[model samples]
Target: MFARRALLGLAAALALSTAAPAQTQAQTQAQAQAPNPRVRIETAEGPIVLELYADKAPKTVANYLKYVDRGLFDGASFYRASKPPGYAPNDYGVIQGGLQNDPKKVLPPVAHEPTTQTGIKHVSGVISMGRHAPGTAQADWFIVIGDQDYLDADPKDPKKTPGFAAFGKVVEGMDVAQTILGKPVDPKAGTGAMKGEMLVKPVRIVRVRRVQ
Candidate 1:
């Protein structure tokens, strides 16, 4: 009777071990399938839809959404389109947009969430914050037209090499980005590194809002 009872207990334990994972797996699947937040950027050129990765870059997403909610980006423009000289202009580079640090429209800067921490790289269609230092990123951001993994954090000295905070990607309207990138740029309009990258006539951001 003692051996029978021990075997019954062992069988019961085994049954629970198998049953628990099934339920856990269902919950995990449900969580994984939950959709991320999507935003639509209405531009004079066209519309650009973004899917933000709140799971990977919560703070960054929150910062961006704040601007969207307040309509701070409604009248902003895509002012800069950057690509290396001799490189194919239409195929590679980044397009930057925001209020351009309008004193009234800009908000306090958000903490940086580097790619090393978020696992969000600067790949084609990826959107990342633009900052002079890691923590200075505010409303200004950019979208990569091609893979620019060099923007990812350098693990060697992350403090000095912390990369841009990439929180989302262009899920639709990449053609609008490409079209903006191909627009005319002024040779002496911008300052410093941006000198030649400024669009002659900046593309107007008609509106920026959350997608349902």
Candidate 2:
């Protein structure tokens, strides 16, 4: 009886010893695979959901979330619908929105997170910061309606522009975004690159909030 008990105890110990490393490894994998944070933008046209790449662009994501948490983006509008000059209205473009430099709501500009550093790209539905120069991004941001690889950082860029800070992508309500893109633009509303791209009736952002 004693010999049988000893054999059983040894078998249990061996099993546990072999399982310990595998269990720890599984836990580590779970932590690494944890999902990124997401937010929903409630708009007059509809809701657009985005999954922020906090892991890739920590500063940009945190800055955006600050605007969301502070309700700064509430009642803001998608004021610009930019398309290539010759392209069809809804075929390819970006829709921009934010506090629009509201003196009371706009926060301090955050450091730019270039695509080169973040490993994010300006692909379809990607959301990126709007800035005149690097590190000047405040509350304004835009969502790409289609792939805009030109927006990605290029070492060979003669202008040496660091490209936009892309932090997230639209996860839902792209149709609503498209609809806004197709809306009317005042013939002479915007300035410079945004010329003729400002939506005549800006799409109101009802609210912005985090989601699981």
Q: Which candidate has the highest lDDT of all?
A: 1
Please give, for residues 19-104, the per-residue lDDT of candidate 2 as tens digits. Answer: 99999999999988988999999999999999999989999999999999888899999999988767787879999998778888
lDDT of each: 0.94, 0.91
Candidate 2 regions exceeding 4 Å error are 1-32, 157-159
Per-candidate clashes, comma-separated:
0, 0
Clashing pairs in 2: none
Q: lDDT tens string, model 1, 118-211?
A: 9999999999999988899999999999999889998788888898899999999999999999988998889987989999999999999999
Model 1 bad stretches (over 4 Å): 1-33
> Per-candidate RMSD vs. true structure?
5.9, 4.6
Report the C-alpha displacement of residue 5, candidate 1, in angstroms.
Answer: 39
